[model samples]
Target: MSTSLLIMGIGGQELIVIVVILLLLFGGKKIPELMRGLGKGVKEFKDGQKEDSPTEKKTEVEDNK
Candidate 1:
């Protein structure tokens, strides 16, 4: 299972409930915008992880020494 599902412990019913609540709160039109923003945030986080990987950092430290 994905780390998020493991951490949240949300099952099918709970996920459905959350989706229903989001639809009610944001409506159909705004949901896509929210999802787009979320996708961008996740992409940025992954890019940051790649730039800060341990092996690259180790090599930089060795080069400096």
Candidate 2:
């Protein structure tokens, strides 16, 4: 299947419209700050996933024992 099919039928034009709406809503000056916050959120989510991985849990259990 094509990538658009995987995205539930949202194509390139739809993506552009969504980005344009975001830009209009947040304004150009605030977009960078919004993106920076989003980046930090993603980073924190990844870090949390790493901390909760099976290997980390196993190590914690061994340390406790």
Candidate 3:
């Protein structure tokens, strides 16, 4: 028999608990604004990382020459 290691498989109940915890910590009024800011921050960070990848760096050097 195959063995599985995951103890707490995430489901609807887990999501509801997570939402309730967030609501308690940040309150209902702030959740949307916080989530929006978090999304923007993650997007910008990923974009910045992608722009610095090796292929882009090689292109930048070729353009400068």
Candidate 4:
């Protein structure tokens, strides 16, 4: 299992340091809000992709045929 940090050329220790820096910069209370926004953005992106999926449109057309 390759970690994304490794793909980005960062090591595990660098990941820890980055997390700690974020915590310090954003503080504990604000981190959850940031994560929540990130989650919502990802969910919205996935939903948008689903809405635009050509395969689903093709399937519907085939069913009507």
Give candidate 3's TM-score: 0.77
Q: Mark the 10 consecutive residues where model 2 has the least summed lDDT.
A: 1-10
Point to the candidate with the largest lDDT: 1
Estimate the overall C-alpha local distance difference test score of candidate 3. 0.87
lDDT, candidates in the order shown: 0.94, 0.90, 0.87, 0.93
lDDT of 2 by residue, 1-65 (tens): 57765679877787789999999898989999989999999999999999999999999999999
Candidate 2: segments with Cα more than 4 A from true spot: 1-6
Candidate 4 structure quality by residue, lDDT tens digits, 1-65: 25876788998788789999999999999999999999999999999999889999999999999
Model 4's alpha-carbon lDDT is: 0.93
lDDT ranking, high to low: 1, 4, 2, 3
Clashes of each: 0, 0, 0, 0
TM-score of each: 0.70, 0.75, 0.77, 0.76
> Which of the numbered candidates is closest to the native, going by highest TM-score?
3
